[model samples]
Target: MSTTRTILICSGKGGVGKTTTTANLGIALARQGAKTVVLDADFGLRNLDLLLGLENRIVYTAQEVLAETCRLEQALVKHKQEPNLALLPAGNPRMLEWLKPKDMQAIVALLERQFDYVLIDCPAGIEDGFKNAAAAAREAVVITTPEVAAVRDADRVIGLLNTQGVQPVQLVLNRVRPKMMSNQEMLSVDDVTDILALPLLGLVFEDEQVIVSTNRGEPLTLSDSSSPAAQAYGNIAQRLQGEDIPLMDPSQARRGLRARMRKLMQTRIF
Candidate 1:
């Protein structure tokens, strides 16, 4: 199949679940028969392999290609769980300068020739690793948790994406607790979308399953079934396929307007 899409999952701050989003979205896309790949561009701090349960199997990473030890295709590890999905791990112990922007373009350009979609897992912070990931993808997904720090960083990343001429900065709000949001205690969907001024790809509620799944090196999207967060990510995958999937409302656990209005005020005054 011809590749026509590339998505870079990025965050200006750390601990915002960019890797997790990249992995699961790739799974979701692959599930829909889209030949997909998640490139771990977080050189020297790679974790997409571990997140996808392919850590131990990664012998040749992206670093190998940049170091001239192997070709780009030589480093890819097919997902143990996702038949249609594959992963390209990051740096190697001997290769520290693996974050070069051209290497990323070369690798992703090669991937685009074979896969339908390539999702890049960007490193945290606006540094060399981040630039490498941005150079590989034509579009971007800014992942942020509904917290002060993550949101601030996400805003900065969105600005950078725009500056790069990356039209359409998509937002993925992760780890949201609607109960707190409704209580006017946390940031709501509106709060984040308004500040970033971007289209929302998904809203992942704070789910215990996510942490549990991550620890097992599995993405929640695989067996999301009735899980709200899983369902949200799945819908996001469908959207990427050019389908107009309707957004699902978070469970009462997500709360209602009284809480949303409260969240609005809390964010405004802060």
Candidate 2:
């Protein structure tokens, strides 16, 4: 039997790629032979279904499951590209009036029985929606960007998670611009990690292909996606599966051979 693990993917603010991370991670996990289900826990403002390209196929939303109008299995929209992956999309905002933390927990408990991983795409902010998203999560992955405001908000969310007894809140830094970091205009990985003080999950640089893939409603973790963001998401999924993979360092990749050699020589023992 697969021991289901629930992970809530959250951000302190919006536009930090929280849903993007959840979508890609789900696809990656599915590719790795894990049965994964991603929930659009943003409730009234569902976009995960759109991201997974299953918007048209979503005949039954989570609201229907909560209302007992449909079974949970009926509400799951399986990925066309990945059979092992499924999505439980958010429901109507008006119908979500009766949705509570316990309701979320019950849904997660049912999902946990069947899949290896259940990733909840949490809504932005610290409102009731946040609590509902975090309620049944056994773990959390906080998403942030290389900006001051995002980092600060992430820190606040981490504190909230800690107080709520969410164990091992990992950090995934998204939209990292290495050029800005090198120019001292943006927060570096070290800077963000220092401030957040959370275990680093992964890093995704600012890649245009990510936006293109989002617009196309196909996650970049597809078999054909060669974008840097796609590889970062793959790495994160491996790490989540307890694989020891080094985080992507875009700055290192941009360095010239001479610069790399100089740094290597400066740090060499012999």
Candidate 3:
């Protein structure tokens, strides 16, 4: 059996942090001494390169590699800070018209020979883009927020993944607001897992730092930042490597937030 783990990071709906998770998770895995490459399969938007700060460095893409105009080594853009991680840029949006499952498989097959992990950043929604991305993946990570619409969409995607024979699909609940969840405002983690019927991989809190990092074209895991989302991504990477780490509880998180707020107020008062 091939040891390369080709995982598709997908979400059935947009705006659910799918690309963000892919970028962070790729960096996290690389930091842990894994040879990881993130393949940008979202040809329409192709934001993975931007998120990884390799947008300007992309001279060629998977299209050129497959067309025999350029070699695979010429097409891959390695991360400047993290040498262990590299990115395979997606083909032009026009490739979607003629991109077959075999073409995706061919690309992934080439990648599998060199890397320990191939993280495919799938396009959002259950459409042609999603189908093409899922075609080459051996496993999948389904990202969803705590919103009802996102969860509903995730459940449908899970069913589709099952039909496609993707094994051991996991869920990562992103943009979770502990206060709202504790107050019965947003859907709880259990609510989502119950509906999707997949193992919960990790829970990322709604952090403002995520926006700051993305705008700066840096992943939180790249630096030793103390961001909760960064830690969550790292933990998710560790769990993916078969490490035993405890999941963070929303109630505890809420309490920790209150404590931090109290400490800040007291510092200002004193």
Candidate 4:
């Protein structure tokens, strides 16, 4: 077994596909044979379980574990098909008022002992929820879109993570539209990376299949679906495993975008 790693998947703003990234990444990691557990730190507004298609099997939640009503392991809902993956669902949202970061720290420590990777799906914004989610993570994956507001929020979160001493804070640029970039209506991968100035984990193109998969309660990376988003997610998972997979292009002009991101990854610069 490899050493355990706890990662917080968060964004400064909502609707940037943070939960989607966490769900797919967790499944992708599990598909690679890692014992992975995704914890929903969003409290009352839990959505990770739904994304993983395990919402119906949630017999217990993180709140129950914390309240001593159930053991931590008892609260875990195993993936129906992916044996190596499981979910720790969020409990009552009202619990957030009293939940502290140290409590999260303990839960993360316990989960790390049993899983190779603990992925925390953090709530949006820089509030108590974000602090509690980021508290236990040694590494953070900030999710953002190409819009100026999202990028600015991500930069703020990154700065906050730095202040919290989280090392190797990586960025996952999501919902990239290639055609818009070509028309100069959207920021290019280079534009986003230049402003963020962080190590690039991967980039996901805007794919309608992602929405379809989520609606079907399935992960995009579960099969060789050929969805550009699915392929991008697979590459991101491989990169997370420290593999040297080439960055993918999520646009109609696929090769160009891939080459640009590939060059950036190799050169460690924008």
Candidate 5:
């Protein structure tokens, strides 16, 4: 089993695919035969379990274990296909604030023995909830889109991670539309990397399949097929394992008809 057991997925702002990235990365690692557990720390928002299609089966929660009402094993909700992957849901918002940080640390230490990787899906925003989510994590994955707002928030999160002594806060640039970047209308992968100044973990293209999968409560990394986003997530899992996997350049990823036309137009403009 790998010694580095916990990875926290965090972001300073909302609508930047933090939870989706968390869910799919768990899917990726588990498929590789790692014993993985995705812990939703989203508090009130609580969408991680839904994204995995395990909402109805969540009888026990992290709160239950904290309250000493159930064993952590009893609280684990197993994934349908992957026996190696499990989920420990964050309880509802109203009661989450009451969960002490010491209890959380104790639980994480206990869980580290049972799994190879423990991914904590942190809530958006840097509040008490975010502090609790990142408290015991040694490593982190900070996800953001190519938008300026998301990029800016990611920088702030990176700064906070450093302040907390969290080393190697990796970045994932998601939903990057290639055409707009060439036209100089949107933030490119380079633009985001330059601004955030963190080690690049993965870059996921704007994919229609991502939306469809999310709406259906299915994570993108489950199937064998490789969409732009799915492949990026898979690569991220390998990177987390300390493997050197080359990232797919976002511009190189979108090689469809639309991107071809946009590339031609840009060449003509120059």
Candidate 6:
């Protein structure tokens, strides 16, 4: 039996920041001295390597390791800056037709022996890709926006995860705009939690810095960035490690935004 925490990072709908959360969370966990490996289970459209800036360094993948063509260490692409973290693609996109749930299980079983955390970046939707990813995961973090459709889809995904015996499914509400939420223009945190009925693991506010970091192949949490999203990711990682950190307050976030705007005006006037 392995003590590794195998967690699947998934979202029912596309463009909900599933991969972004997985990438940043992996870096955050590794920075805290945990041996983490992010397994890109969305191999058919995998971009986790690109996000982590390890795309060019991946000479092999889980497919090669499973096929006995390469060693697991050879397939693992160690992060250049965060050596405590590694990235492993599930398979080559062209050759993923043969991938199945058992294959995913096999790959993860091997990973569990060496890593303290195995974060699987699952493909969007409730298709075969999702089923295969869920098969190997002991727990999951379902990402969603404050949109009705995303929440609906996440609810369905949670049901599927339950059927698969994935324990302790947690929720990560992404793309949160504090102003909109406060103004009732978007779904309130309470609204989402009431629908999903899962423990709120974290809240990621909408930030332009996330786009900047993604395009540069550097996750926001990889550095000492003071961005709200970065701080939120770090806090989430702390909570995952069983640290009793309090969740961020949306009202406080809105007030903080107002203060920043006021400071900008003062700086320009001076």
Which of the numbered candidates is closest to the native, going by highest TM-score?
6
Report clashes for each candidate as comma-separated counts. 2, 0, 0, 1, 0, 0
Residue-wise lDDT of candidate 2 within 1-73, one digit each (tens)? 5478889999979999999999999999999999999998896888898888988998887778878899988
Residue by residue across 122-203, what tens digits does model 6's lDDT show?
9998999999899999999999999999999999999999999999899999999999989999999999999999999999
Better of 2 and 6 by lDDT: 6
Score candidate 3 by lDDT.
0.92
* Candidate 5 C-alpha error for residue 212, in Å: 0.9
TM agreement with the true structure for every prediction: 0.88, 0.92, 0.94, 0.91, 0.91, 0.95
Model 1 is weakest, by summed lDDT over 10 consecutive residues, at 247-256
lDDT at position 138, candidate 5 = 82
Task: List per-candidate RMSD values in Å.
Answer: 6.8, 2.9, 4.2, 5.4, 4.4, 4.3
Q: Of models 1 and 3, which has the larger lDDT?
A: 3
Write the number of the candidate with greater lDDT, choosing between 3 and 6: 6
Clashing pairs in 2: none
Q: Per-residue lDDT tens digits of candidate 1, residues 1-270?
A: 554688889988988788888888988899889899888878578788888888888878766666789987778889887789999876674575745788788778778888888888888999777877787779888899888889898988888888888766788888888778877789788888888888888888888887888899989887646777788889889987779987656545555679888878889674
Please, what is the whole-model Cα lDDT of each candidate in the order they appear? 0.81, 0.89, 0.92, 0.87, 0.84, 0.94
Better of 4 and 6 by lDDT: 6
Residue 18's lDDT in candidate 4: 88
Query: For this target, which candidate reaches the highest lDDT against the unseen true structure?
Result: 6
> How far out, in Å, is residue 89 in model 1?
1.4
List residue ranges in candidate 4 displaced over 4 A: 250-270
Give stretches of model 3 more than 4 Å off: 257-270
**Residue range 1-270, candidate 5, lDDT tens digits:** 548478889878898888899889999999998999998888687898889888898888888887889988899999998888899976756786676666667667877988999999988888887888788788898988889888888889888889988877888888888888777799877878898888888878888998889888788899975787888889989988889998886556548889888888889674
